[model samples]
Target: MSQEVRTVEQQTPSNRESAQRMALRPVFMPPADIYETKDSIVVLTEMPGVSSEGVDISLERRVLTIRGHSASQDHSGYQRVYNEYTDGDYERVFTLSENIDRDRIEATLKDGVLQLVLPKAEAAKARKIELKSS
Candidate 1:
């Protein structure tokens, strides 16, 4: 084939221009389960059809954003008669608290699930205060 694969960056712009163009596919806000452990806050986002290489996570100021894109399978010779599964992209944003250790944050994607580990800052960690005898 002489054509090259087109990435999301080349096709879709981050900023949505409502008046100028129509969306090619639907954009979904993936469902996330957020919980806190002793040392970290974990977030599990479910984004079907998305892979580790296709996902991007960024933290700016106090906001965290997740963007994922899944390439549609090519149907060169076959024509779609009845379509059930939806082909779309995923996006979500979160506001981080002061207690989160931004520098130590980590993320991983496996089997279409995005896992984010936000470590707690030292100041916010639970530490028992020891009593001293006078």
Candidate 2:
């Protein structure tokens, strides 16, 4: 239904200086599609050149975050090269409502595509109201 985009920043005592330097890397928002079913909500994100090990999915304080890092391609034999694509990291956030079951959420990455399944909470799922004849 409705979702909001959010950015999360984590600060650690040791990595504060390094984190500031790391911010120079380009951060791209990979394209994503989100759909809802009767039981869960599915999110599909296109993160080309990103592997399963390079992806991180986390949910904290009702904020779902999807982050991926794509390594740059290596052209060993070629000398001069013109490039149209840039290798960078991806980050996207979605604010979830109480309808989502945070504890049961699942994520999978395959072929540079990340899939997230957010199951609906027990009280949020639709239920049939039977009519009782008095």
- Identify the candidate with maximal TM-score: 2
- Regions more than 4 Å wrong, model 2: 1-22
On residues 38-126, what C-alpha lDDT tens digit does candidate 1 reach at each position? 77878899998987787888877656777788778658998888888777778777765645688898998888899999887888777
Clashes of 2: 0
Error of 1 at 52 (Å): 1.9
Model 1 misplaced regions, further than 4 Å: 1-22
- Each candidate structure's TM-score, on Cα atoms with residue i matched to residue i, is 0.75, 0.77
Global Cα RMSD, each model = 11.1, 4.4
Which pairs clash in model 1? none
Instruction: Please give the lDDT score at residue 76 for candidate 1.
Output: 92
